[model samples]
Target: MSVNLYRFGKTVVTIILKPLFRIQTIGTESFPKDGGVLICANHIDNLDPPVVGLTSPRVIHFMAKEELFHVPILKQILPTINVFPVKRGMSDKGALKKGLKLLKEGEVLGLFPEGTRSKTGELGKGLAGAGFFALRTNAAVVPCAIIGPYKPFQKLRVVYGKPIDFSQYREQKISPEEATEVIMDEIRKLISAHK
Candidate 1:
């Protein structure tokens, strides 16, 4: 049902992107087959979500900006593809609860710790949300990187790094802010590797 629609959307996106961006993915084998998983990446542009969703082996439920959900068509279609809205800047308790519930059900949750796109392509300071969820759920956090010029007719790369365990950090009483730094550092390395 929903899964079929997701795959259909991915197929459509892949077909559309193939002739435009030369999409290349590396280290996909590191993505977990099943479990409560979190895919944390650096945000560069609006295309980051769909690009990651289309390339990922698993169906990715993205935390989209709340504004996108208000668009007429997307308002009706987003839920079918598992995209939920999250208000930016201030905390959105409902979105956080939804994310936790999804992870508890062993779903793949995609998030960008930077919260907003980086216009310069340089990785920015991460928000604590990703680490907070990782610590709370003890989910495997897979660091992802999106590289290359973010435009049509250019080579774009999606790189995945090994899953990071936040359980130890949680046990050691490390703050979510500290854990975010660690996760973002790994994401930085992945992006650097491909450059």
Candidate 2:
């Protein structure tokens, strides 16, 4: 039921955004057709989630800040569209469990590793949480980038980087910080490439 509503919402959003923003996408073929996958991207504006989610073919189960869920109407609508809340600035064990469960079920999980949006719209250092989940679940990480202006009628681009597999790194007992640096590097490249 949620999946159906997600699709419907995506279609509706696409229709609205396409004409207004001139949104374009590339490298979608990099997405894994099956198995658990992580979509990690840079967060610039609040519009990033809906833009990326609507543009991608996969139904992205996005981890959003708990505050957004408190909005009067959005609290009821967001869950139906695959948006779930996570407490910020601390480890939320319940959110982690929910994320792992979703990945174990071979679903796609979308996250912004920067932990928060960049006020200047520039890339920021990524938190280790994304790498932690990637290592724990052995999920493929797809680095994503969103570029260009956020205003209406401006061209916006979404680029998906090739999946980075950390299984070898996990086996070698690499530090979470090191692994996160690698993931963030790929995301940085994607953002730079698209710009």
Candidate 3:
């Protein structure tokens, strides 16, 4: 019924980023006008989230690493940026729950299926966590691909792939890891095209 747009994210996105990047967003129309969506993307630059956010006309919420949440200014602004924290390694129950809650509330949550940044800025191995969330929450999965080295003033193409139904996996009641793989693989195919 509602799309959760963060208070700070709206302002920061418009003010800090809109003028700087030549962001080309593809397939945004594919996203459901109102529903939970997991936006799984590749991680290369620290700027990935904002770049993705600005490129998107819709507001996207992200589960950031605990490390980034500790920084003072970022700590305050991150949450406003619609960014929340997640502990890496092992299962972060808190983060997962929060992500689910956001989705159930009709928020678009962003995730790096790659889990970590690519040292060489290429597509890396994707963690199935995002897919797990999709299956568990019964949310649509939007696979996005961003092509361009992480550099400012550089024109880049952020390709938003079609929103795929994970209903098949849901019907099978597959394991979370298994479901995650299916979701990540879709994201991988999108990434492969750009790479």
Candidate 4:
């Protein structure tokens, strides 16, 4: 690949994604400036990851779908941008291992608890993967919400909630329902503030 492609991607991201989408980040003070953390958020649009990443001052490693990797052009620079692929639905142990390793290595793991984009324009039920990762790694879980349609020439905001401790899940061995409720409550609050 020529150096031109890399230059072109950076230019497009800066010129297009940046200028077109006016992003506002609030409560970023809640994010741990340094350390391994499981950053989970609601999934409304595919743009959520990049919007959150750009807003977050901390270096974040994103867990994107494996299908996006099919792009020959993107394959060149995605790595430099800190994006990774995860096989949706199935265990995808490879992705799990990678996610855990990133946390263990003291890196931020960007995840979408809903697992996929919401089809009905309402917050969908979140999956247990985020909980499983948080429990396994003992990383702080920061609930975030990407609030808006995020179309070109439109302004959007991403709200980050404080990191929640999950030690109880490991010690008390509470039911999954309890853990799910704990998470949804935080996510709900983040969404409500945007409206």
Candidate 1's C-alpha runs over 4 A off are: none
Displacement of the residue 134 alpha carbon in candidate 4, Å = 1.0
* Alpha carbon lDDT of each predicted model: 0.89, 0.87, 0.77, 0.77
lDDT of 4 at 3: 40
Candidates' TM-scores? 0.96, 0.96, 0.86, 0.85
lDDT of 1 by residue, 71-143 (tens): 9999999999999999999999999999998898898999999999898889999998998888889678999
Superposed by TM-score, candidate 2 places the C-alpha of residue 168 at a distance from the truth, in angstroms, of: 1.8
Q: Which should have the higher TM-score, number 2 or number 3?
A: 2
After the best TM-score superposition of candidate 1, give how far the Cα of residue 71 lies from its true spot, in angstroms: 1.6
Off by over 4 Å in 3: 1-21
* lDDT of candidate 3 over 37-110, digit per residue (tens): 78888887777887788766567888888998889888876765577888888889999989999999887889
Mark the regions of model 4 whose C-alpha exceeds 4 Å error after superposition: 1-19, 175-181
Cα-based lDDT at residue 129, candidate 2: 81
Candidate 4, residue 119: lDDT: 82
- lDDT (tens digit, per residue) of candidate 4 on 76-172: 6677677778888787898889889999888888888778899865777877777778777777889888878768778777888988888977688
lDDT of 1 at 18: 57
Worst lDDT run of 10 residues, candidate 3, spans 1-10
Candidate 2 residues 1-195, lDDT tens each?
377788888889899987798999999887888888888899998888999998776888989899999999999998898888999989999999999988989889999999998999888999878888888886778989889688899889999999997879889887767777888899889887778
